[model samples]
Target: MENKMNRRGFFAAMGKFMGLAAVAPAVLGGVFSNQANAQEKRRSAGPGASAVAGSMVDVNDPIAKAVKYVEDFQKSPASKGNKCATCGFYAKKEMHGATEVGTCTIFAGKLVNANGFCASWNKKA
Candidate 1:
């Protein structure tokens, strides 16, 4: 009787292991495909586009001060034609007339004001 119980236990463990092995490939494949899709989106968005979400830059940051970044574009003298949305380094997507917040290449993935400008501003052609 004991021998029979041990055999049943062994078979149950084996079944579970087989099930996991079979599902692993599918799970891994999904992850890889999702990553590939994200990469393609970034590439299509142009040079400064990155797949990772970025943090908003602090106004007190040294770089911000050096670049003369202003949170509100209306407050800056150079805001006329150098807003982030119009800059060469801005990476964002606009949907349904709504502009998404974007990251700037100058800040190396840090989020910037869409209507903001910096010393590195290059007008988007």
Candidate 2:
């Protein structure tokens, strides 16, 4: 009878611990998520920049379609050493302060694909 009582107490303690373990990740994720967002904001800076962060340039946009914009650099005819990142119109310094993606003077406030290509691409001078 005493052993039965001890086993019940142990099971209760373990149940409480398991519940806490499950809730800890959610609580911590919420706490750290804000910090991560703040860091992202710092990285995304440009005109209409709020909407550009983590967004890919739409290939169907008029200019993109007209220019035959290809999202993947490798698939583009300009694949060899050509990409928005190295293009003259790419505003690498003005948007996001990162080269992984940026705005294009041609796109005007819209995010351009980093590994993308277009007919307007010119060698960065």
The best candidate in terms of TM-score: 1
For every model shown, what is its TM-score relative to the native structure? 0.57, 0.51
Q: Give lDDT tens digits, candidate 1, residues 1-125.
A: 99999999999999999999999999999999999998787677665555554567787999999988887777887777568888888877433234456778777757777877777788887
Model 2: CA > 4 A from native: 1-55, 93-99
Alpha-carbon local distance difference test for all models: 0.77, 0.75
Models, CA RMSD each = 4.3, 7.5
Give the candidate number with the greatest lDDT: 1
lDDT score, candidate 2, position 67: 85
